[model samples]
Target chain A: EDKVVQSPLSLVVHEGDTVTLNCSYEVTNFRSLLWYKQEKKAPTFLFMLTSSGIEKKSGRLSSILDKKELFSILNITATQTGDSAVYLCAVRGGTSYDKVIFGPGTSLSVIP
Target chain B: SAVISQKPSRDICQRGTSLTIQCQVDSQVTMMFWYRQQPGQSLTLIATANQGSEATYESGFVIDKFPISRPNLTFSTLTVSNMSPEDSSIYLCSVEPRVGDTQYFGPGTRLTVL
Candidate 1:
């Protein structure tokens, strides 16, 4: 069975803190990994990583995937109170590699 | 990125009632997906709707409980039948503009069963 696992299920950090969220997966075939942030009812897209070592960055958020290790990491620097939300990591992999399996997520609470 | 929208942003319904959520995309998409997220939980695939074929449901989901319809490339609907308190969740619709592309999500419909 394909599964995605995330570490430190929940985190509470002060303002301007840097947090690293981890995601590991076990699947039949490795494809792409994605990150999303959910504040309310909707989950906003964050980043999609398909290569190893190379990082994708957007403002204060960055992510990288390690296919050999079958894991990915999302880093958030200088996090503000507005950044308080659940960070989700998902992978698209399986026999056909079409379905996206999501991790339990890391809930970050940023205190100002 | 494709713009997606869902109707009935939030609703509180009685147990045993049913709700139909609609999803609309700005552009044509080959595959649309439906997901359910329980409170404090991650998103779970409910089904996948294609324009010209019947929706394919994921494991632990049945068509009778969650019927989906994809009338065109840009629109789809998911109906949740016989609601219960356990059925309370946020229903999200997502679309992949092309095959093997990133999936974009809708704002989601929050349902509460009382």
Candidate 2:
């Protein structure tokens, strides 16, 4: 069975603090790892990583993948109240590479 | 990325009723999917809406309870049948413009069963 796991199921931090979320997976035919931020009902795509040793960044959010270790990390710098949300990690892998397994997610609360 | 939208942004229905949610993409997409998110839970794939074919459902899901339709490449629909309190959830549709592409999700429909 394919599965994705995330550490620190919940977290709390002050504004301007930095946080790192971890995701590890075990699946066959690993195709890609993706990160999404769910603020309300819908989840917004943040990053998709297919290769290792390379970082993908967008403003204050950055992510990296380690294919060899079968894990990925998402880092948020200088967090803000607006950043409080559930950070999800998903891995696209299966016999046909059409399956997407999501982690439990990390609930982050950034307080002032 | 294509713009995706879902209909009936939300609804409150009585038990035993059924609700159908529509998903439309601004541009044609190759793949579309339906997902369910219960309160405080992660997204669970319901099915893959294949154009001109029967929707593929995941394990623990059935076609009778959660029927899907994909008449074309840019549109799809998911119907939650025989609703119950346990069926109340946020239903989302996502589109993959092409094979191996990142998926973009719709705004989602919030359903509450009474």
What candidate 2 gets wrong by more than 4 Å, as runs, is none
What is the C-alpha lDDT profile of model 1 across A7-108, one tens digit per residue? 989999999999999999997877789899989878889998989999999999999999999999999999999999999998988876478888999999
Whole-model lDDT values for every prediction: 0.92, 0.94
Identify the leading candidate in terms of DockQ: 2
Q: Which residue pairs show collisions in model 1?
A: none
Please identify model 1 stretches exceeding 4 Å from their true place.
none
True contacts kept of each: 0.77, 0.80
Q: Which window of 10 residues has the lowest lDDT sum in candidate 1 chain A?
A: A92-101
